[model samples]
Target: AARLRAAGEAAVARHLQGQVGRAHRVLMETPRMGRTEQFAEVVFAADQPEGQIVEAAITGVSGSQLVAG
Candidate 1:
């Protein structure tokens, strides 16, 4: 219950502290067969208390099919 606009820096820090714990990154590999492309690698991180993908970076052999979540 501190105000930021009235309190400044310290209040800002407290506000951000209310956020959830840091997420974890997990790399998932999917193999491709009969294709000239290499395996697909996706970097994902768990979200808040749910522990699901909230942020991600996906890249392939050709840098194609890249996606972020």
Candidate 2:
């Protein structure tokens, strides 16, 4: 009986492991859907006669700086 129980437990564990693997695969393969706001970065130089406006797509943020791509 003990051996049978051990075998049953192992079978159940394998089934659960397969289920978890399938779930993980589904999550990794799924495309994320959401709305993202557009942002721009502008730089002004003190020596420049006219201020220049630089437009770029903001991909991420690092500390207080914005990463553009």
Candidate 3:
């Protein structure tokens, strides 16, 4: 599990870096106090203010997919 998680994270990092430029920050929000927080990982092009913000998704699992902004 740990190894799979690590590989998935690394894949996400690589995908984000390639698609959206270098990752700048990660933001999280809770829909409700008791609910799990949703996360957004933001990345931007070098010297540019605009880029893509991708929501958390598992990309390594058999049927999983990732969509970039």
The 0-to-1 C-alpha lDDT of every candidate, in the order given, reads: 0.32, 0.31, 0.33
The regions of model 2 sitting more than 4 angstroms off are 23-69
Residue 38 CA error for candidate 1 (Å)?
37
> Model 3 — which ten-residue stretch has the worst lDDT?
28-37
Of 1 and 3, the candidate ahead on lDDT is 3
TM-score of each: 0.22, 0.31, 0.31
> Which candidate has the highest lDDT of all?
3
Clashes of each: 0, 0, 0
Query: By descending TM-score, how would the candidates be arranged?
Result: 3, 2, 1
Off by over 4 Å in 3: 21-40, 43-69
Name the lDDT value of residue 40 in candidate 2.
18
Tens-place lDDT digits, model 3, residues 13-55: 6654444332233232222111012233322222222232323
Q: Compared with the true structure, what per-residue lDDT tens digits does model 2 show for residues 1-69?
A: 999998987775554333321211111111221112222121112222222233334344333223333
Clashing pairs in 3: none
Query: Candidate 3, overall lDDT?
Result: 0.33
Q: Is 1 or 3 the stronger prediction by TM-score?
A: 3
What's the lDDT for residue 64 in model 1?
26
